[model samples]
Structures are given as C-alpha cells and as structure tokens.
Target chain A: MAEIAWREALNQALAEEMERDANVFLMGEEVARYDGAYKVSQGLLAKFGSARVVDTPISELGFAGLGVGAALVGLRPVIEMMTWNFAVLAMDQIVHNAAKVRQMSGGQLRCPIVFRGPNGAGGRLAAQHSQSLEANYAHFPGLKVVAPSTPADAKGLLKASIRDDNPIVFLEAELLYGVKGEVPPGELLLPLGQASLKREGSDCTLITWSRMYYHAEEAARQLEAEGIHVDLLDLRTLKPLDEAAILTSVRKTNRAVIVEEGWSFCGVGAQLVDLIQSQAFDDLDAPVQRVTGLDVNRSYAAVLEHAAEVNPARIVAAVKQVLYREEG
Target chain B: MAPAYPKDLVLRFFRSMYLIRRFEERAAQAYGQGKINGFCHLYIGQEAVAVGVNEAVQPRDYLITAYRDHGYALARGADVGMVMAELFGRGTGYSKGKGGSMHIYDIEHNVLGGYGIVGGQIPLAAGTAFAARYRNDDRITVCYFGDAAANQGSFHETLNMAAKWSLPVIFLCENNRYGMGTAMTRVSAVAKVARRAVAYDMRAESVDGHDVLKVYETVKDCAAWCRSGKGPVLLEADTYRYRGHSMSDAATYRSKEEVEAERKSDPIPRLRAWAVSAQLATEAEFDALEAEVKATVDEAVKFADASPEPPVEELWTDHLVEPGERDVPPRERVRGVKVDWPRYPSGQELRVKWDLEPRIPVQDGEPHLKKPA
Candidate 1:
C-alpha cells in the first residue's frame, strides 16, 4: 500500500487507465499544460502527449458533448469539469445526451464516458461554486453517480467509473484533495452502488458519503466515547444505491442518521431517509434523523458558510438525537 | 470551382430531392390523420440540402442533424418502410419505436441521429470526426442544423474545437429563414450563418439551396477539404421551409406574400425544371421519376399502417448493457460493494428479441401472420 494525497490517487487512476487503453483519453479546461485547475491531472499531458491529454478552451457544454460523441464512437473519454459547479453549464449534454444515449439508441450505442471533478463547497467559494449537485445528477436514471470520500475510494471508484460502459458523474470533494490516505497498491477498482461500513457499532447507524463520511466517522468516534455505539456507513455510490447495506445497518441499529454536504430539501440524505423508512420501517426504534447543509445557497462569509455546512458536531448531534440521548 | 456533373448524376439529384419532398408530404398527412404523433418537423422546402449533401459523401461517411431530419434519413438511403414504421411507433422501426420522429437513428447508414435539441448534434459531429481522426480513418462527419442553431453557444464552441483539432467534419447549416416561428433576422446577430465560421478561422461558404447542383458541389468540396485533414468547413445552404416548424405551428409570424416568394424557388420543382431544361433528362423521364417516387411513398405508408405497436415488455429494456455483458469489465471489484443487477419489473420478462408475428387473434382466433413457406 502507498500513502498519497486524494488528488494523487485520482491522477494515478487517470494515468493507469490511459496507459491501459489507447482509446482512453482525458479532455477538459486546464487538463493539459495547466495540469488541471486543481492539479488532479498533473503530469498527464507530458506523459500522454497532447493528442491524448487534451487542453480544451473553457467551453463545458461543447467539450462535454464532444466527449459524449467520442464515447458514442468507441473512445473512452474522461472529461474533467474544472468543478462540478461549472458542470451546470453543460447539464443538457450530461442529462439529455450522455444519460439517455444508450437507451435512446436501444443498446446500439453507449456513452462510455466519465464526467469528474471536485464537487460540494470549497471553503468560501460562495453560491455559484459551492453547491453540492450529486442529488441533481442522481435524479437522472441512466447516469451512475459516484462520490469518493477517501484517497483509496477515489482511485478505486474512478478507475471503475472509467471502465464502466455507462456515463458516470464522479464527484470529488475539493477540500479533501490534500488529505492523505493509504490506497491499496495497483489495480484496486471499487464497484458502484455499494456502501462501506466505515465503523461497526449497534446503537445507531450514521449514513453519509464523500466528504461527509469523514464527519460521520468522527461523529461515530465521539459517540463511542460517550457510550453510544454507532455504525458508520459510507455510501460510495448514490444512484444504484447500496440498499442492502443500508437496510442491514438500519435493521441492526434500529435507528439512523444521514449526513450530507448538500441541502436537506431533496438531497441525497433525503433519499436515504426514504429508503430506510420504506424498507426498514418495522425495525426502526426511533425516527431517522438527518444532518445536511442549510437549504439556502452557500454564503461567502466565513461564519455563515461554516454554519451552513454539516460538520462532525452536527452529525454527532443528529446521532445523539436519533439515539434518544438528546431532545428534538 | 464546381465540378461538371454527369447527366445521370444530375437526374439522380432531382429524384433524391423529389423522394424527400414526397416522403415528408406523406409524413405531414399522417400526422394530421393521427397515424403518426409527437413533434413532427417536416423538411418540406429544404429537401435539396439533405439530398445534395448525402450525394456528396460516401456511405461510410457519418451524418447527423437536428430534429428536422426525415429528409436526411431518406437521402442517406434509410429503408423508406422502416423510416415510416418508426414514425408510426411500430416494432419494425429503426429505433424499435422508442425514438420518435425527432430521434431517428440508423447505424447501418452511419446516420448518427436526428437529435431533438437545437444545436445538440454540433459537438457530437466534432466528436465523430475526432473519433475518425483518432482511429486514423478517412471518414468525414457532416452535421446539419438550422440557421438559428448557428447562434447557439455550442455551434461556436464546436466549430472552434473542430478547427483547433483539424477534425474531419462538415458543419452544414440549412438556413431555412425561421427557427420554429422566429425569423433568422430576429434571432441571429449576423445576417449570414456561414460568416460565423470566420471567428473559428475555418472556411465557410454559402450556396443557393434551391439549386441542388450548387449545394452538391459546395458539400463535395467541403468533404474533400475535411478528408485531407485540413480542418472543418462550414457551409450555409440558403433555403426556406414551406411548412411551419412543427405539426402544431400556425406560422403566424410570416406574411402570405413572403411565403409565396420563397415557394417560387421550391427546390424539387427547380431541380426538375433544371433537369429537363439542361437535357439531363427528358420531361417524360422526370414525369416517370415523380410517379416512381409517389409509388415508393405510398408503399411506405401502407407498410407503416400495417405494422404493429411495440410490445409492452420493451419499457424495461436497453437502459444499459448488463453486468458481465459489457464490452469491457469493471476496473476492479471491491468486497462489500453490491453490484446492482438490472431486474425486470413484475410481470415483464427479459426478451432478447421481439416476436413480431401478429399477436391479436384473426378470424379463427389462431396465429394469422406466419412466415412464408
């Protein structure tokens, strides 16, 4: 196993995948020469050459649709949106074209493409740049949505996403780029639609994903110290959701708390809550609680931004409330 | 410089345009009769553009267009019966009735699609060219769109990328005067759609769309330029649509006089007149061709009318290639991560292919439509 930053893990996956298949290429703004805006594509251009590691002008819709078109004709293109916030500009291509092509073409054609980049709040980037769009993308049926919380998960899930024959929206946490973790050495690919049991306990189940997984884990540790054992589940993939894992955990703990970086209204956490209620309702000892980003758009002010986000404290509070340790 | 076309080739161009005109006329009539439904955009007056471009390129070359694409499909040699069956939403259709009039696709002819959204296929055209260049193939992709689509942001963006990459793509803009009900003058900042290509440093040309020969020559040159790895080219075919944008359109925006003036340059009649006057074919020969085209369209309508609707079980199929059936396997498998296998909803069985025999009982309440002995 090698210890690397989350960004390096993603870079390694891209490099390895490009090396594995000649048809695989990377394209986006700053992916070439600039080494990516967040440097996730660092050293790719020099290694793969300009033809494979393309630097595109800042036209998201054009490039994204181009990537879909390339995928249609047997090229595996990994498109890096400078950030998922900017992906909103290319939503039509992502939503209408990439997601619908395989089915629309009746299996005659498939878009084997990946749209990846940092998602969720990056400190005080404010409203436009700090929104969490996983739920919006997950709402589309044909798309596979993966949010990797760790360096290991990032490398594994990204490789799987690139190899998968469907369009994927791989959401990476901008804040977690510098965070270091041990990734399993070569060829470690994680499947989509699976949840990981980060920490095992029995009192309450804390479900989260991406950057929020860390908060849920921290909250689980804090709850353990307080004599309230919690089961932490990191839902790696949102769209073909790990229903079995979620239901098993909820059935065991008999209580649940979902934490997410996106807003509470119609967020991924809301979906989790619905799943637990519908599938594990008879096993629940208490109402499923949620700790999510405030419903309003992200604010530029540091204090307001901090307050708007869900942290370990919020997760812990929600867990305690679900476990009946605190009043609603 | 235009190449001197052979007499037979000129006659063939008239036939191709006439076929599209008649096919679309029948499609519009079917829409009125409720035999076909949903967002049917006719290629009534712009038949010359599709036929000319299709005639300019090889069968291996790719073609993509906007929602106004029945003419392109027919000109590219899609089976007339199958195309009409698709409009009828039948199991025998090209897309198995899943894609309606705006989403016609035929992999056999290399017709990428009839994309529903405005300017959606522009980037896709560039991508197909990128694929051709990547594979070191000589195939060129021709993308057809309306005049108003030239004003879309993707059009400029795709043109720039195609030029920068030197992709083998021809951006054909059929400037039909109106996008839906809005006039080109009202929607586009520039009067000439081809002039927008200047911003990308790509070659652009405008041709008289009513003259099939001019369109054919321009596209032939453009295709050659693209295949030589020079770069993408933009060709604007100045045309006009005789019908409204779609079946539901009232065409309240234009005057009767303007419509009449544009109709005087109707491409099918113009081509037929030129074919006869230029001694490319005799007037009697043109008359025989028209009769042949009418018969072909009538047969297509008959086939569509007799075709059955797609089965109810098809709703759950073709979403994605199932696991273990994908062209490539997942990068690696992780323990504890559940691989969700697609399951058919209750009462629906996974059918590899549709049994197209007549399902409803006939006179004797037994299977009626059987394969010939």
Candidate 2:
C-alpha cells in the first residue's frame, strides 16, 4: 500500500483504465494541456496524448452530450465536469439523454460513460458553486452514483465505475484532494453497491457517505473516547444502495444517525430516513436522527457556511441524541 | 459529379418515397382509429430528403436525427414490420415498444436514434463521427433535424468542433419554414439555416428539398466533401411538412392554399416524371409498384398487431450491465454490454438483416400518386 493524495489515486485510476482499454478516453474543460481543473488528470495529456485526453470548450451540455454519443457507439468516455455546480448547465444531457437512452432505446443503446468532478461545498464558494446535486442525479434511473471519501476507495470505485457498462456520476470533494490516504496498487476494483464498514461498534449506526464520512468518523472517535461505541458505515454507492448492509447495521445497532453535507429536505439523508423507517421499523430501538446541512442556500461567510455544513460537533450531538445521551 | 443513378436505384428511390407516403398515410389512419397515439410526426412532404440523403450515404456510414424519423429508419434499411411495430408500441418494435415513433432506433443500420428533444441530437451526430475518427474509420454521419434546432447552442458548438477537428459529419437541416406552430423567422433573425455555418467557417449549402434528383446530387457532393476529410458540411433542405406537427394539432397555423402551393413540386410525381422522361420506367409499372407498397405497409400493421407486449419483467432488465467477478471461469460471460455482446438485450442480433427489400420493378413504371394531385 502506498500513501498518496486523493488526486494521485484518481489520476492513477484514469491512467490504468486508459491503458487497459483502448476504447476508454477522457474529455473536459482544462483536462488536457491545463492538467485538469483540479490537477486530478495531471500527466494524462502527456502520457495518453491529445487524442485520448481532450480539452473541450466551455460548452458543458455540448460536450456532455457528445460523451453520451461516444458511449452510445461503444466508447468508454470519462467526462470531467469542472464541478458538480457547473454540471447544472449539462443536466439536460445528463437528466434526459444519459439516464433515458437505455430505457428509451429499449436496451438497444447502453451509456457506459462517467461524469466526474468535485461536488458540494468547495471552501465557501457560495450557493451556486457549492450545491450538492447528487440527489438529483440519484433520482434518475439508468445511472449509478458513487462518492468515495478516501483515496483507496476513490481509486477502486472510479475503476469500477469506468468499467461498468452504465452511466455513473462520480463525486469528489475539492477539500479532500490533498488529504492523504493509504491506497493499494493494481486492479483495485471494488464492485459498486457495496458499503464499507468504516468503523465497528454496537451502540449506534452512523450512516453517511462522501465528505460527510470524515465528520462522522471524527464524531465516532470523540464518542468512543467517552465510552460510547457506534458503527460508522460509509455508503459509497448511492443508487443501487447497499440495502443489505444498511439493514444489517441498523438491525444490529437498533439506532441510526445519518450525517450529510447537503440540504435535509429531499437529500440523500431524507431517502435514508424513509428506508430505515420502512425496512428496519421493528429493528430500531429509537427513531433515526439526521444531521444535515440546514435547509437553506449555502452561504459564503465562513461562520454561516460552518453552520450550514455537517461538522463533528453537530454529528456528535446527533449521535448522542440517537443514543439518548444528549438532550432529545 | 455523381454517375447516372442505375435504373434499379431510381426505382428503389421511388419505392422508398412511395412506401414512406403510404406508411405515413396508414399511420395517420391508425392514429385516428386510436391504434397508435403520442407524437406522430409524419414525413409526408419531406420524403425526398429522407430517401435521397439515405441513398447518398454508404451502408457502413451512420445517421441520426431529431423526431419525425420513421421515414429515415425505413430508408436506412430498418425492418418495416419492426418500424410499424415500434409505432404501435409493441414488443417487436425497433425499441421493443420502449421507443415510440419519435424515438425509433435502428442501430444495425447505424441509424443511432430519433431524439425527441429538438437540438439534443446535434452533439450526438458529431460524436458518432468523432468515435469513427478516433478509430481512423472513414465512416461519416448524417444528422437530420428541423430548422429551429440550428439555433440551439449544441448545434453551433457541434459545428465548431466538427469543423475544428475536421470530423466527417453532414448536418442535414430539413427547414420546413416553421418550428411546430411557430414560424422560424419569428425565432431567429437569420432564418436560412445553412448560412449560419459561415460563423463556424464550415461548408454549407441550401438545396431544393422538393426535387429528389437535386437532393440526391447535393447529398452526393456533400458526403464526398465530408468523406474527403474537409470537415463537416451543413446542408439545408428547403422543404415543408404537409401535416400538423403531431397527431394532436390540426395544423391551424397554415392555410390550405399555402399547403396546395407547396404540393405543385410534390417530389413523388416530380421524380416519377423525370424517371418517365429518362425512360427509367413507363407509366404502367408505377401503378403495380403502388399496390405492392400498400400491401407491404398493410402486412407491417398486421405484424405489429399480432406482436405481444414486452414481458413485465423487462422493466427491471438492462438497467445496468454488471461484469461478474474478477475473472471468468472458462471464457468471458455475456455481460450484456452492446460492445461485449454481439446480441441485443432482447436477444436480437446487433447486425440486423433487412428482410423487406422493395419489390418495385426496374422497368419503366406509372406515376399516379393518388393524393395531392
């Protein structure tokens, strides 16, 4: 295992996949000569050359639709959106074309493409740039959604996503690009829809994914030091959601607290709440508590943004409430 | 310069035009009887463009277009029985009843799809050529869309990219004057769709859409220009749709006189007259050809009517193609990926064989259109 930054892990995954399959190619704004908007694609242009690593103009919908076209004809295209926020411009292609092509063509056409980039709050970038839009994509069928919080998971999931014959939305956090993690080398493909057990405990289950996993992990540590142990499950795949793992954890713990760095209403947490209540109704010792970003537009100020985002303090408090340790 | 079209080829064009006209007429009748519903954009007056452009492209080349697509699919060699089934939303349809008339797809013929969204197909057209170019394949793409789609950002962006990369794709604009109920002049200041290619520095042309021979000649030249790797070419076919936008509208936006004025250049008769003048066919043969096409369309309807509905379990299938395990036991398992599996999810072969070749005789034939005379 090699300790590397999250960007390198993703870069390695892209390089390896491109080398493995001739059909695999990468395209997006600043992905070639500029080395990607986040440097996640650094050295790809030099290694693969311009034909594979394409630099597209600032037409999100145009290029995104083009990727879908390429995918339709049996090309595995990895489209890099500068950010999930900018992806809104290309949502027509994503929401309508990518998600509906398979079903629309009655399974004649398959969209085996990946649209990846940083998602959610990118350091006080405000409302437009910081919106967490995974739920919107997750709502669409014929799409697989993955967000890996660690470098190793990122490499594995990204490789699996690229290989899977389905359109996938891979979300990354700008803040976590520089975060270091130990990544295993070579063919590290983790099958999609499998949730990883981040931490093991019996008291309560902290269910979260993407960047929220870190905050939840920190909260779990603090609670552990105080003599309370909980199961922290990071659900990497959101669409073909790991219902088995979720049910197993909730059935074991009999209590749940979902942490997410996105708006509460209609967010990923909202769906989890419904799933837990419906499927694990008899298993719960207490009602599921959710700590999510406040239902409001993301603010630019640090303090307001801090209040809106899910942090260790809020997560700890939610866990305590679910465990009946803090004020309910 | 295109060589003289063979007698069989000219007869095939007439058969294609007649088949489309008859098919649309039957489809309209079906829609009225409530056998088929939803957006049924017929290609009645625009028959020449579909047949001529399709004839010009090689079988290995690709084609994509917006809605109003049954004609293009049929001309590109999609099974008429399946095409009719698709209109009826039956299990045997091209998309197995999943894609209605507006979304007919014949992947085997390289007719990518008929996109419902107006300008959505523009980028897809360019990308199909992009994929071919990536493999150094000489195959080009023919993208069909209405005049209004040209105003879309994707259209402009695609033109820029196709030109910049010198991609082999022909953007065929069927400028029927209006977009739905609204006139194209009201939406964009520059209504001539082909002229807009100047801004992108791409090859462009405006052609007589009503004349089948002219459209065929122009597409031949344009396709050659694209295949030679000059770049993408935008060809605007000056034509008009004889019917309403869909089955729903009564076509109240236009006048009966306006429709009549356009019918004088009716491609069916115009081409027949030329074919007769060229001694390609005599008047008597056209009558028998019309009967044969009508029977063909009738058989299609019966085939569609008898086809079963897709199994309910089909809803859950083909959503994703998950490769099993790290290694295959003996050989690779069929993962259902189109590229991996040579067969379609419905167990249909990827390369579909066209069963219903036009039976129109090569000898001189008659030219009685039976409508708009």
Candidate 3:
C-alpha cells in the first residue's frame, strides 16, 4: 500500500480505466489543458493525449448530452462537471436522456457513462456551489449514485463505476481532494453498495459517508477515548444502499445516529432514519437521531460556514443523544 | 452528369413518401378510435424531408428526430408493423410498448430515438458525432427537429460545441411554420434556422422540401462534406404540416385558406408529378404504387390491432443492460466515413438539365445566401 491523496487516487482510477478500454474517454470544462479545476485530472492530457482527454466549452447541458450520445453509440464517456452544482444545468440531459435512455430504448442500448465531479460545501463558497446533490439525482430509479469516503474507497469505487454498464452519478468532495490515506498498490475493485464498518462497538451506531464520514471518524475517536464505543459504518454507495449492513449494525448497537452534510428535509439521512425505524424498530434502544447541515443558503464567513455544515462536535452530540448519554 | 436519376430510386422515394403519408393518416384515424392514445403527432406534410434524407443516408449512418417521428421511422426502414404496434402500445412494439410514438428507437435501423423534448436531441446528436470522432469511425449522424426547437438554448450550445470539435453530424430543421400554436416568427429572433449556423462558423443549406429529389441530393452532398473532415452542417428544409401539432391541438392558430394553399404543394403528389415528368415512371405504375401502399397500411393496422398488451413482467424489465454485457469495448464496424455521394446527374448543377418547375411559389428575400431561388 502507498499513501496518496484523494485526488491522486481518483486520477489513477481514470488513467487506468482509459488504458484498459479504448472506448473510454474523458471530457469536460478545462479537463484537458487546464488539468481540471481541482487538479484531480492533472497530467491526464499529457498521458492520454487530446482525443481521449478532451476540453469542452462551459456548456454543461451540451457536453453532458454529448456524453450520453457518445455512450449510446458504444463509447464510454466520463463527463466531468466542474462541480456538482453546475450539473443542475444539465439536469434535463441527466434525468430525461441519461437515466431514461436504457429503459426507453427497451434494452436495445447501454448508456455506460459516468458523471463525476466535486460535491458539497467547501471554504467560503456560498449558496450555489456548496450543495450536496446526491439525493436529487438518486431519486431517479435508472441512475446509480456513489459517494466514497476514504482515498482507497474513492479509487476502488471509481474503477467499479467506470466498468459498470449503467449511468452512475459519482460524487466527490472538494474537502477530501487533499486528504491522504493508504491505497493498495495493485488493483482494488470495491463492489458498489457495500458499506464498510470502520469501527465496531456495542453502545451505538454512527452511519455516514463522503465529507460527513471524516467528521464521524473524528467523533468516533473522541468517543472511544472517553470509553463510549460505537459502530462507524461508511456507506460507499447511496442509491443501492447497504441496508443489511445498516440493519445489522443498528440491531447490534441498539442505537443509531446519521450524520450528513445535506439539508434535513427529505434528505438522505432522513431516508436512512425512516429505513432504520421501520425495518429495525424492535431492536432499537431509543429513537434514531440525525446531524444534518442547517437548511440555509450557506454563509461565506468561515464561522457561519462551519456552523452551517456538519462538524465532529455535532456528530458526537448526535451519538450521545441516541445513546441517552445526558452528561459529560 | 447523367440525364436523370435511376428510375428505381425515384420510385422508391415515391413509395416511401406515399407510405409515410398513408401511415400517419391511419395513425390519425387510430387516434380517433382511441386505439392510439397520448400525444400522436402526424407527419402529414413533411414526407419529402424524411424520405429524402432517409434515402440519401446510408445504413452505417444514423437518424434521430423529435416527437413527429412516425414517418422518419418508416423512412429509416423500421418495421411498419412494429411502429404501428408501438403507437397502439402493444407487446410487439419496438420499445416493448415502454416508449410510445414520441420515443421509438431501433439499433438495426441505426435510428437513435424519437425524443419528446423540443430541441433535446440537438446536443445528443452532436454527442453521437463525438463518439465517431473518438473511435475514428466515419459514420455521420443526422438529427431532425422543428423550427420551434431551434429557439432552444441547446441548439445554440450544441452547434457551437459540435463546430468547435469539427464533429461529423447534420442538424436538419423542418420549418413547418407553426410550433404548437406559436409561429416561428413570433418566438425566434431569427426565423431562418439555417442562418444560426454562421455564428458557429459552420455552413448552412436551405432547400425546397416539397421537392424530394432536391432534399435527397442535398443531404448526400452534405454527408460528403462531413466525411471529408469538416464540422457539423445546418440544413433547413422549408416545409409545412397539414395537420394540427398533435391530436389535442385544434389548430385554431392558422387560417383554413393558408392550409388549403399549402396543400397544393403536398410532397406526395408533387414528387409523383416530378418523377412522372422526368419519365422515371408512368401514371399506371404510380397508381399501382398507391394501391400497394394502401394495402401495406391496412396490414400494419391489422398487425397492431392483433398484437397483445405487454405482459406485467415487462414493466420490471429493460431498466438496464444485462450485467454480463457491461464494459465490453463496443462492437463497431471500424470502417471510417465512406462518402456515398455518387458521381451522377444530381444536386444543384443537375437542376438545369431537368425542366421541372416549382408547384408552389418559391419565397423571396431569403435570410441566407444558400437559399434556393
């Protein structure tokens, strides 16, 4: 295993996939010559050359639809949105064309394409650019949504997503781009929808993914030092959720807390709470608790921004609430 | 150049045009009987555009169109029985009755799909061309849309990107006067859709869509241009629809006299007149052709009627390609773009040799220089 940043892990997966399949190509705004907006696609243009690593104009709908068209004709196109926020402009193509193409064609065609980009809040970037858009896309049936937490998982799940024969919304976080972890030197293919139990205990269950996973990791460390052991489960894929893993952890711990960096109203965490309450109601010791980003437009100030999204403190508090730990 | 086109090809054009004409007529009748429910847009007057382009396009090439796709599907050689069955929402339909009239697609015919969204296929068409460029495959794509769709942001976005990449595709607009109830002049800043090509650094061509020979020859020449490593081309076929936009449209927007006047230049009769004048066939042969088309249309109706409703299990199926079939490099005929434009009496220069006259008054004060006189 070698220590690598999240961006480098994602870059390796893209470069390897392109090398494996001649049909796979990458295109997006500044993806080629600009080395990607976040530098995740750095050095790809030089390695793959121009034809395979293309730079598209800032026409999200056009290039997104273009990716769908290329996929329809047997080419595997990985379209990079500068950020998941801009993907809203291409929602018509995603919802109407990408998600519906396979079923609409009566299975005559395969839309083997992936729309990958940075998602969720970062720095002082307000409102438009700081949204977690997984739930919006995951609502559609035809699309498979994946949001990996660690560097190794990002690399492995990305490879699996590229090789899969369906449209996938691969969400990556800007905050995790520079985060470093040990990634396997050889090939790593993590199957989609398989949740990883980062930590196991008997007191409570902490379920999270993507940016929120980092916060949950810290919360688990804080709780472990104070002798409050909890099960930390990272859901790698969102749409085809790991229900068994979630149910098993909730049954064993008898308490559950969901931490997510999204608004609470009809959010992924809300959905998880519903699933746990309905499926594992008899096994629970107390009602499930949630730690979600405040439903606001997101503030530009550092203090307000930190308070708006999730933090380790919030996750720890939610865990205590679920476990009925009333005092310090 | 030769004196005239082959008699077989010309007659086949008439057969295709006449077949589409009758197919839509029966589709309209089926709609009245409630056999075909939902938004059914008939291709009554734009037969020359689809027949002309479909005849000119090769098997390796592709065709995608808007909701008004019954005729183009026929022109691209999709099974009439299947297309009719799709309209009737039967099990035997091309899309397993999952996709209705607005969304018929077939891989065998190289027909991408009949999209329901206005101007939605414009960007998608460019993407298909992008695939060809990526694979170094020479298959050029032809995308069809209406005048109303030209006003969409995607039309601008797609054209600019396609031209920037020099993608091999043709964006053909059928200017059928009204977009739903709104006229093109009322909505678009520039009613001449072909003129929009100039902003994208691409060439444009406007042809008399009532003339099948003109449309067929022009598309062939345009395909040749795309194959020679050029950017996308925007071709405008000035035509009209005799029917309302869809089954629900009352068509109270246009005057009855305007429709009656446009009917005088109906593509079916006009092509028959031109083909007969050029001595491609006799009147008796055309009459026989008409009788044959009527029988074919009747058979398609019977086939659609007899087809069973899709099974309950069908709803759960076709959501994704089989897992085993995923990620395999595409099965493609790597043969690069082969130009099918034959060296014969065809295209604009060939027009002088034939003594055919226009049936409708050709419009003047054109927006583009390539506008047919």
Q: Which number leads on DockQ? A: 2
Best by lDDT: 3
Ranking by lDDT: 3, 2, 1
- Name model 1 segments beyond 4 Å from true: B1-4, B324-373
Error of 2 at A34 (Å): 0.8
lDDT of 1 by residue, B30-49 (tens): 99899999899999998889
Clash-forming residue pairs, model 1: none
lDDT computed for candidate 3:
0.85
How large an RMSD does model 3 have?
Answer: 8.0
Provide the lDDT at B45 for model 1.
90
- Structure candidate 2, residue pairs in collision: B281-B364, B281-B365, B282-B364, B282-B365, B283-B366, B286-B365, B286-B366
- Per model, state how many residue pairs clash: 0, 7, 1
Comparing 2 and 3 by DockQ, which wins? Answer: 2
Q: How should the candidates be ordered by DockQ, best one leading?
A: 2, 3, 1
Q: Once superposed on the true structure, which residue ranges of model 3 sit more than 4 Å away at CA?
A: B1-3, B325-373
